[model samples]
Structures are given as structure tokens and as C-alpha cells.
Target chain A: MMLRNTSNAVYRVAYESVSKLSRKLNAAKNIDELSSVFDQYLKYLFNFNALRVHIVVGSDHYYFVFPLKDENETEFWENEVLNFEEGLLENGVPICQNLNAEQANSLIGDDVQNPVLWGWNFQYEDYCAVTSLIADENNQFSSKETEILGLVVDLFTLKYYELITKAQLVEKNKLLEEAVDIIKQKNNWINQIISDQQNVIDERTKQLRYQNEQLMQLSVLNAHQVREPLSRVMGLLDLISFVEGDEFEEEILPKMKESAKDLDEALQVVINKSIEEIVNVFDINSDKM
Target chain B: MNRGSNVLKVLLVDDQKITNFINLKVFEMVSVENQTIDYTDPEIAFRELDNHNPDIIFLDLMMPRLNGWEFLDRMKSQKIELPVVILSSSTSPEDFSRAEQYNNVLDYFTKPLQRDDIEKLLAKL
Candidate 1:
């Protein structure tokens, strides 16, 4: 009856520990958070002195080691882990072994005496995870314990995939926001360019109006003032037509010469004035530019 | 009407000496019997208007000292009854309208005055 009572207590403790470990794993948000949870809980649940986790997704490998005993031992363990062959643990198999100092030295280049080694391999989709645990020979793992540890490794693999997927989603959101900001900036720049072009059109319209006014003024001057001398030349020519040869030479030729000179001078003045006005308009436009 | 006994008196007033000379030549070509008086200055022309007692006057519009419009106004005030014609280089409609407002102004003509225009005036006389 006492043995039955002791077995009931042990079962209750194991059930409580598994519930607590599942809660901690579910609460983990990132790699660092999950790694800390594993470091805190896995050793206590499985009675391991040290732990190493190696996960490979695509070309990337994520590795973690907890409670490193010494630099030499860590170096030796790292070499063994790097050279470890696959297929040692099959899909449904878990490995648990006890090693002497000589065996440990041959495997890991370390003289660790009577070490207990346990490892498991798990795969989900295209990703793989390999886990290793080391303990003192006095604390050899049972088959039931190895089965429980296999379940823990599987839980870690699923949590790791969740953490990586969440991180990728966050990175994509940041990139999308940056792309939107760039589009908004380009739109603003195009609006500014359109406004500047409108201003240039308005300025050109004003200059054209000014030039039209100058042209009208020049037209008026040409019609009235410049035409006066031309009329005199016409009048002189009419008189020459009326008179005979010698009379035309003596009487009308000198007057015709004078009238022609006056016409030439008037035309020159008008041309110079027009050129001056055009130059002034160009100078004003250049200054604005 | 009595072309043999009575001489036709003609007067010309213009700021341009060339215009007056041309008009005098035209009158000589038309008839040497007609008396022609010409002046470059409108003020002198205005003072001599009664002294000349011209039968017909050819007046230019734009002149210094006294313009054609002012000369016409003075002629009105002095009650100088004479047939006056505008002989100007201006083709402005406004000048033509303004000259038509005067009772003494017989017609408006743009220069240089043709033989046809002078013959028309002679026909009126």
C-alpha cells in the first residue's frame, strides 16, 4: 500500500512538470525567449547536465549550447557535433548511450569518464532539428525518459518555426511601409513641378501682352508720322509729271531729292525705335530668367 | 464765271515749303492768268487772308504757330466769308469729320493734290 502511494506521488509530479513545460513553450515569442525557456526547463525535466540544439532551415544553421563546462570540452563537443553523421537516429528512433573515458575520447577528443549521451532527430516540412544532451553516468536516462525527451525536441522544432515565420512577417511589413513612403514623396515632387510650369506659362502670357502693346504703338507711329514724308515725295513726283523736261530738272528734281532724304530718315528712326523696344523686352525676359 | 475779265484768286497755306512750291507749280500749269499766293507760316497767312481776298483757299491742317483748325476758328470769328478746302497729308477719318463741321470748308482732299481735284474745284468756281 505504501509503494502504491509513492508511485502515485511520482506520477503526479511528472504530470505537473510536463504541464508547466508545455505552458512555458507556448509563451515563448522569439528565438531568445524560446532558448531561455529550454535552458531553464529542459535540464530539470530530462535530468541533463548540458544541452545542445542544432536546427537547419534552407542554408541557415542555428546552434545553441547551455552550461558549457570548460573551453576545451566545448571545442571537443563542437568538433563532434560538426562531424556527426546523419541517419544515426531514424525517424521514429532515439539514441541513448553510456560511454567510458576512452570511448568519449575517441568520439569527442575529450577524456570524460562514464558520460551519459542522449540525442534525437526531428524533421517538419523541409527543415530539420538535431538535439544532444549530456549527463553524468550516475544519472543514466531510462527509455521512458528518452521518449519524453523526444516529445520535448519535437515541441522545440514547432516553436522555432513559429518564431522564424513571425520574424519574416515583421520584416515584410517594414519593407512595405518604406515603399509607400517613397511613392508619396515622388507624388509630391511631381505636383511641385506642375505648379512651377504653370507659373512659367503665366509669366510668358504677361510678356506677350506687353509686346502686343508695343507693336500697336509702333503701328500708330508708322501710319501717321512716318507716312508724312512719303506723301511729300508723291506730291513732288506728281509736279514733275506735269512739267516738261528742262522745267522738271530745274524745278522738281531738288525738291524730290529732299523729300526722298526725309523719307529715308523717318524710316530709319522707326526701325531703330522698334529694335530698341524689342531689345528691351528681351533684356527684361532674360533678367527674369 | 467771267473767265476773261476777272482773275481767279487762289491762296495756299502749308507748313512745308515743298508743299507750297508744288501747289504753286500746279496752279501755273493749270492757268497762268489765275493769281496765286502761298505762305509757309499760318500766322502770316491768317493776317494776310483779307488783304489777299482769295477766291479759294487750300489749307494744310498740321502747322506750327497756328494750326488749320485754329485758323478756321479765327476766320469764323472775323466773319471772313470764303470757300476753303482742306489739303492735308492726313488720311484720318477724324480730321475729315472735324473739317466738315466748319461752314466755310468746301471739301477735304489728301495730298498730293491731283489735276482732277483742282479741275473739280475750278468747276465749282
Candidate 2:
């Protein structure tokens, strides 16, 4: 498939979501808040967390800072900070920050290693101000939303590959079908040739049978009608060949020789016809027998 | 210092550190007096833009989290109608066609963005 005409609007929404989530993840005070926000934001957009989030904070007061026990403990610390801020605010501390108690808690859960310091104001010296570093261990803050979006892109890419493979399979199947058809056609032709050969053999057998019957019929006919006359003609031709030539005898002898040759040729034709009839009769009798 | 206020402030957005450095150098050599806010993180980039309004944006098309087109879309939604020049190594016809669809995109340039290219873009401004 070709690259989709992705709406600039969709791209913008995805981008802003990523930016917002990244900002939130960075603003988060501990690992607990980070993972929760990460999980919540990503569950909607993607299935995997491709971009690993790492949070580390450098505390202003080194003695008060506690080591991050684990990811779960970090979330707990963030929750505690929220409760602490709310308690302080309810007691009448004038804070100009726009974040609500819930929003603040959600923003900076237990992900940070140190207390994030905001800009210090001389007018509010009594209140602690801290800025949060929204970063992984490498100081990179890839938002949970962004990570999920990356996963979506990956899944889409895999789907595209699957489509291509399916198309290839379809083409291969078409070629296979054509090959099968050709093979079937060749088989039919071979079968037809075998049938024709069988037909030819049957015709030749019929002809041989007819010829054998004819020879038998001619054998009977030749015994009565042909042999006696043919024998006499042959004797006369033999006599004419032995005679000497004289003036008057020569003319008479030539005529006699011509007549004997004609008779002999006629007898041979009669014998051949008689034999053909005999074979035909014999072939008919053989079939009956 | 008085003339500095009149200079164009160009924001260079890219995930790679070296690309940002190279672009910044090119901008400088073009005699364009400008301050660049480099954002390797696309999410961070939007915040930087909201905070510091730049005269021009040189945006890369590909990145880990927020791609160039995504960033532009976000910027447009926010009504930040600043001049945006798409800086990408992809010169595919389809890429160019897609870039053309965006009204905010002043031009599409194939990268290693040169000083001459920057100068040419500045002249257009």
C-alpha cells in the first residue's frame, strides 16, 4: 500500500498529545506518577511502551532527599507530596500556581529522585519553590503517549508487510492454476491419441480378416474354373517358345506366339481374381467359424 | 544590538544533536542574525515554540516521538501561523506532494541544509 494521506489534523492531535504527556511525565515528581500517567495515556493509543521513561531529580536540600526504593515506592512518594500540598493550601497558603490538588498530584507522582525546585521568589521566601526535570536517565522525556503512538506506527508497518505477502501468495496461486490447466489439456490430448491408435488397429484387424476369407473363397473357385484352362495356356506358350523360324512358318509362328502370350496373361489375371475371391470367402468363413 | 531586534529568529527542530548543530552553523554563515532554540524532543519542541515565538521554523520530517508533519499540525491547530520550512532528506515525489498540501509549509528542502540554501530561504522572507 501507498503512504496514507494522513490528516494534518490527526498528526497535530497526536503531536500535541505527545507533547502534553511528555510535559506531564517531566513535571511528575516521582516514578509512581510517571508510570500511572504513562499507563493511562498509552492504553488508549498503543499496546507497547517502546520508549522507556526514566526520571531523576537533583534535590536542592541533599539531606532531606530520599533514595528512590523502586518504581512503586516512587508513585507512593508522589501521592504523599500531593497530600502534603493540599494540606498546606487548605491551611491558607497563597500559592499562584494554576494546578489543582488532583492535577498537581497527577502531574508529579513518585517518579523523581530529588525535590524539583521552581524559581525562587524573594517575596515568597517562606514557601519552597521547585522546578521539575521531565527527563529519563539520559535526560530524555519521551512521553507515554508518544511511545504508544510509535507502537501504533510499528503495528501499521507490520500490517503493510502482511498485505504484501498475501498479494504475492495470490499471484503464485494464479500461476499454479494455469500450470494445472495446461497439464490437464496435455493429458486429454494423450488420451485422444491412444484412442485413435486403437481405432487404427481395429480397422487393420478387420481388413486382415476380410483378406483371409477372400483367399478361402478363391481357393475353391480356382480348383474348378482356373487351373485346367491356365495349365493348357501355359503348355501352349511353352511350345511356341521352342518353335524355329522359316519364311511362311515365321509369319504363322509369330501369330501363334502372340496368341499364346495373350492367353497366358489372361490366365494369370483370372488366377489373381480367383485368389482374391477365395481370400474374401475365407475371411467371411473365419469370422463365422 | 539595535539591529539584532530586526533579525529573523529561526527555530531548528530535529531529534539528532549533530543535525541541529550543522543547521545552526549554516544559518550563522548565511549572515542571518538569529537565535535558534534547538529541541531534540518533539514534545519539548512544542513547548519551546509556545514560549519563544520564532520568525521561521526549520523542521525535520522524521523523529522518534513527534515527527515534523505532526509538529506542524500541532502548531497549526494552535494558530501559530509562522513561516515553516520543511527540512527533510526524503525527496520522494509523494513526500513533496504531501508537503504541498500544507499551506503553512513555505518550502520543502532536501537536507544537508547548506548555507546557500539558508541564504536563498532568507531572501524569500
Candidate 3:
């Protein structure tokens, strides 16, 4: 009653297939991997020659049809389901229906015998599975074999939650790695800015020290050289008071004129030397910039 | 010149003939001429240091062939210890500080070497 195929002692083989399917589903890393596992194993769970399942979760839809003959692969898509599956989605319950020859031939093509269609609709939370199975007299399900159907429903729910939780965690981990990468880039940028500022400060201090030394040299030159002849002129002017008018005209007066000329020349020396030194300092600073 | 009868024998050494001539007039102003010998060339004056035998040497600092510091160094090397009064036209504090390093350098004066400077020299003498 629980497994209709037990008459052939095939329940052991079906049990092993369902156990392998559960292992494969749990071991699967992503939706694509889970889809491949389902394609390989889901048909072996029940007594059906042909199986068609349409599953909908929110806006995502998956449809898989396995017409197993000569090891044909499962055809899966967002495919349109059979007319009986539309009815089963609306009714939200199990259904046993006799599929006429035309309807049976339309799916597995005239290869079936006395084909009967069984429908199972299972819903949990926002998820729904609409499964329509066609089996002929060759591999028919007893109406009372709800135990195996119940086991399949439990596996679907468990597999769905496992893959969904993994998917959410993977999405969140990707965002976390992106955030960490942005923070590292910002830290490098901040360190670069700080180093640039330190270099600027060091350059400015060096230039100021050089300019200050140049200024001190120039000041010493001016004080000693420029002041020399000017003082000589003043000295000659003071000599006027002691000398007689005739003596002053011959001695102090001509000497005063000469010292004045010397003062003018000394002024030029200071001016030219200061300009040259200032220009040199400016050129050095310009080269650095 | 109230020089206390010791009639100070003075030598004036400067690179400028005009500066020496002006210093000659300072000696005239202080009424100490005939005791003063002036030389525009410091090297000539350094060579004639013994012959002139002056009680005081008014030495100009900046000159050709021998600068004041070198002149002082030459005098030191020759053991020519004389009372040297530096008569430079520099009012720099560094010059004032530098002059202190010479043991034979009696005083520093920025020109003109006026009658007051001569009086101070006489008093110090």
C-alpha cells in the first residue's frame, strides 16, 4: 500500500534512490547544481513512466518534464504546464484522473498503455509545487500510496529552505567583501595625502633655512662694504672745521669729492651683489617647485 | 691736546690716501701733528713699524694686499706688539665682537677719528 512497486520487491531500490537524492540535494551548492541533481534523481522516487512538475516560488517559476525512455534527460524551463496541472493548482489537493488515449499520446506519444494521471499539489509558505504524473498499466500507482508522496513533499521543503538560506548568505558575503575593499582603498588614499603634506612641509623648511643664511651673508656684506666709503665722506666733511679756508679748498674739498665718488661706487656694489644673491635664491626655489 | 706731556707718537695706516689725509687733519684738529706719520699702504706701514716707533697705530680694517685681520696676524707673527686702535668704517656689532679676539687691539673706532676719540686715546695712553 505504501509503495505500489513492492510487488516486484523494488521498494529497496526506490529507497536507495530517494536516499541518494536527499544527499545530492543537501550537497548541492547553488540552484543550478540543485536543478541538475533533481534532473538525475526525482523520477526514481515514484512509480511513473513519465513525470511533469511545475514549481512556483514568488515570481520565479521552474517546470521539469521527464518522459523516461532509453535514459532521456529531463527537459526543464519556465514551461507551460498540462491542463490538469492548472486544475490541480486551483484545487490545491490530490487528484486521481483517467487520462484518455489522446491526452496520454500527446505527452509520451502512443508508447503508454492505459495511462492514468495522478496530480499532487503541495504548498508551504509562499511556495507551491504542481506535479502531474502519468503512468500506464506497466507502472501504475495505487491510490493509497500517500506515504511515499508524503516523504517526497518533506524532501522538497527541506531542500528549498537549505538552498534559499545559502543563497541569502552568499549575497550578503559578497556585499561585505565589497565594503572592505572600499575601506582599504580609502585608507591608502588618506596615507598618501598625509605623506604628500609631510614632503611639502620638509621642502618649505629647507628653503627657509637657505634663504635665511643668504640674507645673513648679504646683510654682513652691506654693513661692512657699503658703510665704508660713506663714513670716509663724513670724515672729510668733519675735517672742514679744523682747516683754513685756503687749506680746505686744496686738501679737504677735493678729498670730499673723491670720497663721494667712492660712496656712489660702494652703493652700486651692494645693490648689484644683493640682486645677484636674491636671484640665485629665487632660481633654486623655482627649480624645486 | 692735554696728553700729559708724553707727546704721543702716532702712526696712521689706511688703504685710502684721502682717509690718511683726513686722519692727518684729525691730528691737526687735536694739535698733535708733527708726532703723526701717515701711510696709505698698510704693508709699507707694517714694514716701517719699528722706525716710526709710534705709541699708537690707527689701523684701517678693509684694504688691498693686507686686510686688517691679516695685518694683525702679520704683526703677531713678527712679535710686533703695538697698541692698535682699529679705525674701520663699519658700525657692525660683529666687527666689534671680532676686534675683541685680538690681544694687541686696544680699541675699536668707527670713523671719523674725531678729537674726542683722540682725547680718549690720550687718556687711555
The lDDT for every candidate, in the order shown, is 0.76, 0.54, 0.76
Better of 1 and 2 by DockQ: 1
Q: Return whichever of 1 and 3 wins on DockQ.
A: 3
Across B15-103, the per-residue lDDT of candidate 3 in tens digits comes to 88877877877787674444889888888999899887788889888889998999999998989888899998878898899999999
Query: Recovered native contacts in candidate 2, as a fraction?
Result: 0.00
Give the residue spans of candidate 1 off by over 4 A.
A1-12, A68-72, A75-81, A85-94, A105-113, A168-268, A277-289, B1-125
lDDT of 3 at A84: 68
Candidate 3 lDDT, A229-289, residue by residue in tens: 7777888878767677699888777887887888888788778877887898889878887
Please, what is the TM-score per model?
A: 0.51, 0.30, 0.53
Model 3 docking category: medium
lDDT, residue B74, model 2: 87
Who is ahead in lDDT, 1 or 2? 1
Give candidate 3 misplaced runs (Cα > 4 Å): A1-14, A25-37, A53-58, A67-132, A142-223, A244-254, A270-289, B1-125
In the range A1-289, model 1's lDDT, one tens digit per residue, is: 9999997887787667767877888899778888777667766665655666677788777776665344335443463334342443245255677767775665444534478777777666968777776677555556667666767777777788888888888898898889889989999999999999999888888888888888876775675556667787887887766677697887788888888898898789889989989898989788887
Model 2 alpha-carbon drift over 4 Å, by segment: A1-289, B1-4
